[model samples]
Target: MIEFDHVSKHYPGGNEALTNLSLEIRHGELLVLAGHSGAGKSTLLKLIAALEAPTAGRVLVNGLDVGRMRRSQVPYLRRSLGLVMQEHRLLMDRTVFDNVMLPLTISSQPPSDAAKRVRVALERVGLAEFENAMPITLSGGEQQRVAIARAIVNRPSILIADEPTAHLDPAYAREIAALFRSFHAAGVTLILATHDDTLYSPYGARRVELAHGKLLS
Candidate 1:
């Protein structure tokens, strides 16, 4: 449900981040964006997530032009998508339950409903019993799972992960990859950006390679 047509992104100082990159990510498909650092992988993800507007051309989600959408509609677009980052961007002071509750709470869902959703999300990420646990007490793998739980807690239609397995050991990295697969199986449109060949090579997903801001395709 994501489309990029002749899209290009140029920073204020004129560094090109994407160059006429055209791609289509189908609904329920697991697409992997693979490349080295500074290869525009993250830039592409940010554009799809609606976190950054392209300098030229278009980015569409479900046929809605992301760059042309009203600023007020951003929250609505974002709420429909789940984003997992390389770093675990959890609130240091909050419990895992509260962190997962943030999305539902921000969307103004009732407390009772948010609690139920949080429980399900944690369970999906294999973190059900860690609800009351502090984020600081968790291992890197656990923290990453918590991040994933927080992302999908809202049941988003699209899930984007940027280097989701960066910090973990090989075992945990595989664990996180499997979790992504599980989400894909459940029909969440998935896009993951990574430099790890082992993770993407074996998956047989549609692969897009980027180098110096251009799709090598």
Candidate 2:
């Protein structure tokens, strides 16, 4: 379970990203965050991954206080979480297979096992044949698929994305949304921050809107 207890995040120059917000994300649930560009949606998502710490209150994920965890422990905390963003963040120089295998390279898993897992993840995303291709060679939607494949290579329990399908056409956006639905159907916890609620509303996702750093609904 993920819990945010009256969390508030303050940045320098009097910028407040989030304010006294409290939320709970139960395991195996798909939740959508809908809001305008600066509604703190991204800030809330970052708190889960420990990319940013709260100025007040605590972020607890599976019983660990993320805001208070030592820097050395952040990576361990991230192992259970998969993150995708608007920017694919792929290494243009690396092949798709290598990019997906990047996460496992840091772990103790053997090379053959890691390679197998990477191929499996790519297959799940329907991109097994493109493993040897480069990110730049694929279309926008395919590049996003590669990013998704890389994210699930470790089989994270929670998958969070920030505006993942924002740049795609309607058809491709639906495809990506369906891909996310497949992951959720497999029992992965999904927390998505997106402007287009229609992408997941038909699937019965619970959505909470944020306005000016506070929950509006």
Candidate 3:
């Protein structure tokens, strides 16, 4: 479970990205953060990931206070989350398999085990045949699939996507949305931040709308 209690995020130069935001995301729920740009959707996601600290109030994940965790504890917290950002953030120089193997490599998992997990992740994202391919050589949608595979390679309990389909065509966008649904159905908690309401509305996920740093719905 994730909870935000009177959370507010203020950036440098006194810019407030979120304001007294309070909400709870239960495990296994598919929650969509929908709003126009600058609605604090990304900030909210970051808070949950512990990538950013709240300026006020508290953010908790599974009863652990994110803002209070020690630096050494951050990695363990992140290991439980699979994050997919708007940017692919791939190592353009690396093979798709290598990119997907990164998280396991950082954790120092055994090579054989990492390889098996990497293959399973690639297969889940329909990129099994492209493992040896370079991310730079793939199409936009395919590259996004590689990113998704990389995110899930560790088999995280929660998946957070930030505008994952922003750069894709309609067909590719739908494909990515279906991919998320499959993960959700398999019991991975999902929190997706996107401005494209049409893409997620049909799935009937709970919608949390934000406007000017505050919850609008």
Candidate 4:
């Protein structure tokens, strides 16, 4: 479980990205953070990922406080969380298999084990056939799938996605949502930050809606 205790983000320019926010997310829940641009959805995700620290309050994951964790422990904390971005930040020069294998490589896993895990991840994302293909060879949706595969390949307990389906068509967007549902069913806690109404309105999942940095509903 994750808890947000009066979290807030204040910038050097005096802008407040998040304002005394507090919420709780149960494990194995598909929680969607719905909001417009600059509505603090991304800010919330960054805090959860520990990419940015909260100016006030605390973020706790499974009873561990993120802000108090030592610098050396930050990477290990992050390794337990899967983060997916809107852009596929794939190394265009590398094959899909290699891209999915990057995390295991960074963690010092043996090449043989990494290869086995990468293949399973690619197959799960329905990109097993494109394992040898470069990022440029795949469609935008396909590349996004590769990104999702990479995020889950590490078997993180929590998954956070920021605007993951922004570049896809309606059909592909729905497909991605379905894929998230599948992951959620498999017991991974999922949090998605997005502005797409098609994803939230008539919403099927638990949601925290924000507007202008304030919780709206």
TM-scores of all candidate predictions against the true structure: 0.97, 0.98, 0.98, 0.95
Give me the runs in candidate 3 sitting further than 4 Å from their true place.
none
lDDT of 1: 0.92
User: 5-42, model 2: which lDDT tens digit per residue?
Assistant: 99999889888889999999999999999999889999
Task: Give the runs in model 1 whose Cα sits over 4 Å from its true position.
Answer: none
| Candidate No. with top lDDT | 3
Q: How many backbone clashes does candidate 3 have?
A: 0
Candidate 4 global CA lDDT score: 0.88
Instruction: Sort by lDDT, best first.
Output: 3, 2, 1, 4
**Taking the candidates one at a time, how many backbone clashes does each contain?**
0, 0, 0, 0
